[model samples]
Target: MPTGPTIIGFDADDTLWHNEPFFRMTQERFAELLRDHADPDHLMERLLEAERRNLGHYGFGIKGFVLTMIETAIEVTDGRVPASTISHLLNEGREMLRHPVDLLPGAEDTVRQLSQTHVLIMITKGDLLDQERKLAESGLGDLFDGVEIVSDKKAATYTRAFADHGDGAQAGLMVGNSMKSDVIPAIEAGAWGVFCPSEQEWALERADPPVAAPRYHEIASLHELPDLVKTL
Candidate 1:
């Protein structure tokens, strides 16, 4: 194994920029739109359930999320949801897709610093077009050796990403906010997994860390990453 990770992967959404907040804001608006049909809390619960249930069919991203919201609205209203309400939900999804890419604190500098010594790659899961747009807008695109806009983050996916870009498995390091998508799977694939918690986490992506994993690490922020990587 290498003395340290030769390839570093980053999760793009909440990890690189402000992402979940947009989704949360949209959900709040959604709850208000359907307040007449159900309590906001109940509506949110239903919407979350819908998103979770539809994950397999729709995969992940704003497009899938919008579809689930439409389904939830119809389900909550017993198929009586107004056409205007549906239109509004679709508009909301468009707005989310158009939302600006706001980089997280220290993300750019840290990545730039790490890129000097190690290969840096972005491994994000979402709609490809939207993700590509964000990367284009982020101004950090040139910093990466490669970018992997994946449907999901699994051990196999991590393994492949590493094999293609790095020395493979033990020579890779994955960093992101979601423990489920960024940390565990990478660690399971024999790479180091570093968790940098985000301000807002999507319910579906939440999970407890593998505390006993020797390569699993949790940091307070991306600001701490360069030093950590140096020490590793």
Candidate 2:
């Protein structure tokens, strides 16, 4: 095994930039729009259920999320949700898509510094166009050696990504906020997994940390990443 990772993969969403908070804000708006039909807590539960069910069909991203919200609205209101409410949900998604890419403190600097030594790749799963747009707007696009906007972050996906980057699993490292999507999968694939917790987390992405995993590491923020990678 390599002394340290030869190729480091970063999860684009919450790991590097602001993401879930926007979704949360949108969800709040959605709840307000449907307040008369259902209690906020109940509506949120239904919306989450709709999102979970639609994941297989639409995958993850703003578009699927918006559709799920619409579905939830229709269901919660018994198909009586007004067209105006549906339009509001659609507009919320549009606003989210147009939201600026706000890089977490030190995210850009860390990537830039690491790119000078090791191969840096972005391993994010979401709507292709939206992810691509964020990447382009982030202005750190040139620093990444490769980009993988996958449908899911499974072990097989990480293995393939590592291989495609000219490295085996043991020579790769994955850094992200979600233990479920970013850390556990990479660790299962024989790569080192670094958990960098984000301020906001989606319920679906939450998972217990793999504390027993020898290759698993956790950092408070992206700023701590460079030092951790150096020790690896």
The residue ranges of model 1 lying beyond 4 angstroms of the native Cα positions read: none
Please estimate how well model 2 matches the true structure, expressed as its whole-model Cα lDDT.
0.94
Residues 72-153 of candidate 2: C-alpha lDDT, one tens digit per residue: 9999999999999999999999999999999998899999999998999999999999999999999999999899999989
What is the Å distance of residue 206 in model 2 from its true position?
0.9
* Count of backbone clashes, every candidate in sequence: 0, 0
Report lDDT per candidate. Answer: 0.93, 0.94
Those runs of model 2 whose alpha carbons end farther than 4 Å from true positions after fitting are: none
Measured against the true structure, the TM-scores of the candidates, in listed sequence, are 0.98, 0.98
Instruction: Output the worst ten-in-a-row residue range by lDDT, candidate 2.
Output: 162-171
In angstroms, the error of model 2 at 145 is: 0.6
Worst 10 residues of 1 by lDDT: 1-10
